[model samples]
Target: MTSRFMLIFAAISGFIFVALGAFGAHVLSKTMGAVEMGWIQTGLEYQAFHTLAILGLAVAMQRRISIWFY
Candidate 1:
């Protein structure tokens, strides 16, 4: 994907990551057990990692410094 698209995707993903994290902590926490909560946490962590990776890729692409790597 292009750098612009990657940046937009990363922004959206980051937004979802934060939203889901808050939802899990404030809303789901009341109903879910520790194990379920842990699962949510794990998923959010992965989402966060990927979001950052996408952001990095977008920056690299924009700078034209890591095109070959991508």
Candidate 2:
């Protein structure tokens, strides 16, 4: 159940990140300067990477592992 929830959350976050990226590229480009757009792009990239990392961690956590390995 927890794994399912985590997967769903990850999907939602990934979708949001894509939407934000598209918005920044198409809509914000008109109003924002190149430097500002670069920052926004960086932020979106970080967010997307973190979201995927969280998804990976959740999957790892669901697996059985020896305490000594940690």
Candidate 3:
């Protein structure tokens, strides 16, 4: 059901986040300095966290109480 979809989406998002992180480190690191790298890492971390939060919200949405709140 929706829970399954949410899990799948979360997994995909996690994979993308890892890929982006690796790209930033391996490809961009040479061009950017430490501060720029830190910024890129922070942005990726925030995106990854929000993607998980979306998954959590989807799970919560499946509950009766959550539906009521929404």
Task: Tell me, by TM-score, which candidate is best.
Answer: 1
Task: For residues 1-70, write the lDDT of model 2, one tens digit per residue.
Answer: 4767888888999999999998988899999998999999899989989999778866765674333433
Ranking by TM-score: 1, 2, 3
In candidate 3, residue 29 scores what lDDT?
A: 98
Give model 1's TM-score versus the native structure.
Answer: 0.94
Query: Each prediction's Cα lDDT score?
Result: 0.95, 0.83, 0.82
True lDDT of residue 52, candidate 1: 100
In candidate 3, which residue ranges exceed 4 Å CA deviation? 1-9, 63-69
Runs of candidate 2 with Cα error greater than 4 angstroms are: 63-70
TM-score of each: 0.94, 0.80, 0.68
lDDT string for model 3 (1-70, tens) is 5767877888888888999999997899999999999899899989889888867867786663355544
lDDT of 1 by residue, 1-70 (tens): 7999999999999999999999999999999999999999999999999999999999998988846666
Model 3 per-residue lDDT at 20 = 92
| Clash count list over all predictions | 0, 0, 0
Q: Which candidate should be chosen as best, given lDDT against the real structure? A: 1
